[model samples]
Target: MARPIWSGTLSFGLLNIPVSLMSGERRTDISFRMLDARDNTPIRYERVNADSGEEVAWKDIVKAFEYDKGSYVVLEPEDIRSAAPESHDAIEVEAFVQASQIDPRYFEKPYVLVPAKKAEKGYVLLREALSATGRIGIARVVIRTREHLCAVMPHGDALLLLMMRYPQELVDIDEYRIPEGKGADYRITAREQAFSEQLIETMSGDWDPTQYQDEFRERLQQVIRRRMKDKGVVRREDEEPELHENAATNVVDFMSLLQQSIARKRRTPAQASATGSDAPQSDGPAKKAAKKVTAKPAPKASTKAAKAAAEKAAGAASKRASRSDSSPAKPARKAVTKKRGKVA
Candidate 1:
């Protein structure tokens, strides 16, 4: 087994278990190094004293807190450890809260909690209890030298210790401007609303995260590989790609797109019979035809109320048309001629 980054005791009221913490995630991002423009040499960094410009040894370094300008309180390693919270060897559970009550932004990083020797039963018991109650434990833990707010919860086979930020650490959402009042602004119609719903239904599928991969990263790697093969290599193109004059082509009117989507879904059986395949379906051609007629002409705040109004209006119009169709038409009245008095 791989060596654990941390070995500590996980504690609740009267329960305790020896646990090892290991990172839950690994970064796969491509890393880059800075190079000199002329010599193409990799840069080296060094720590130096700002006043004397002399290189400082790592062992000689001491951390300090500046309480005032030009004044600092230097701290030694032993002094710092002594001042830290007393429960350094334990994860002390303070409270348990509903999983839904936690704000997503507060959680920072996660680690897998593995059971140590003789602690297997306790670990499984805690994991099962957390899963059954649908609650997560809020706790304070000291991972290295720094203390952190953490959440202890159940994972598939092991427990997860998720680091969290204090409430004060998060910036208030009110600091930024955002669209308000349930989108009370967009002029959405009933037809559009119905179509959008159908479109959602047609496109809905179970999420499989494995189906997607990083396209940009893959393309970047391709460029890197091509350069490695030949330094002077240039990308070749088959033909000039067409440029669209209308920017609104992609941000299509929601309702029109939705209707097209539904129609496409409904036509699948007939299309399958003709093609003899389950694939090959599209709303692109239909959307292109109706783009000019149904595109959202103005870029403005769109709201939800449009659906209610448009549907009501459409329903009323339909009722009026139905009533007119069933009723008999009235005949036009003939003009009455008045007998004029005899004039000489």
Candidate 2:
């Protein structure tokens, strides 16, 4: 069963409609894991004190305010909860404004606001009213103990609650040095202004999200797969020499190892290392070459080979993580920094 991320009531004026918040999006990016290069074991991260390098338990970690250099004020969870704004169990609307007035840059995440059984009629009424007026409810809502300034409006037949950042969150426009056309020694001529409008019209097209994709991610995965296959080819050629020397005895053990590798792969598809004997050789088609293998890879020998493959996989994974960390978030604006308010 799908779970509600938040359960609360939508409020505007005297009317209240019980609503449950459900996430509308699920991220599907390929996730990579960290591994020890030596034995191919996964590496686990620990939250530790920076200076001491000792892992700290959750209970021992306290929220602290760094009021000044080298000074701190610790506060318990209870202290924070008490200081937070009182929860009214409602999204209190401060005003109704033209939906277009809200800049797209201010919007963050979105959730589907589903109505409760008893609140369906009221929900529909509000949805229709908002649609008719073309105005969104500018409201404050508390979700997961955090207050958000949001806009609730009809999106098609559904009500979309778009979380919004405060005005202070936007980078001060004064910081930007916009191109000047007056005293700065440049001016947009009649021809330039007319041509700019013509260019905009030439490029304008309807929004089609399906046409766009994460090409970088797709290309990176392709490279990783290609590298794995190349490593597979190298492994086969390296084993060819040993196979020819002890052709009879080595062949028997090789078959046993090959069978084990196949069975292991069926059990754990992820464990199928790229440079294993089961991998295809470059000399011929994979199916034809597999049918007439002269030698099988030794089981014991494959262990070190697995680790070698792991080292390559781990390196690729590390590079991916580094790229992911540096990639800009899809959202346009940063989280609002609260006015340097006094600590409660």
Best by lDDT: 1
lDDT of 2 by residue, 1-344 (tens): 67988888888778888998888778878898999989989999999999999999998888899999989999888987776679747778889999788789898988899999978899999989998999998888876667889888899889998889999999987799986556326443455445445555655679999999999889778867877988743322233332332243423454443443445445433444554444433234654665556334455455565555555445545566555533332121121111112122
Backbone-clash count (model 1): 4
Local error of candidate 1 at residue 3 (angstroms): 2.6
Instruction: Assess the local accuracy of residue 51 in candidate 2 as a C-alpha lDDT between 0 and 100.
Output: 100
Q: Show where candidate 1 strays beyond 4 Å.
A: 66-73, 183-194, 231-252, 261-344
User: Could you list the CA RMSD of all candidates, in the order they appear?
Assistant: 20.6, 27.4
Number of backbone-clashing residue pairs for each candidate, in the order shown? 4, 0
- Segments of candidate 2 deviating more than 4 angstroms: 50-52, 181-187, 227-344
Best by TM-score: 1
Tens digits of per-residue lDDT for model 1, 267-302: 666677996654323435655756655665432212
- Superposed by TM-score, candidate 1 places the C-alpha of residue 71 at a distance from the truth, in angstroms, of 5.6
Which lDDT values do the candidates have, in the order given? 0.77, 0.71
RMSD of 2: 27.4
The TM-score of predicted model 1 comes to: 0.68
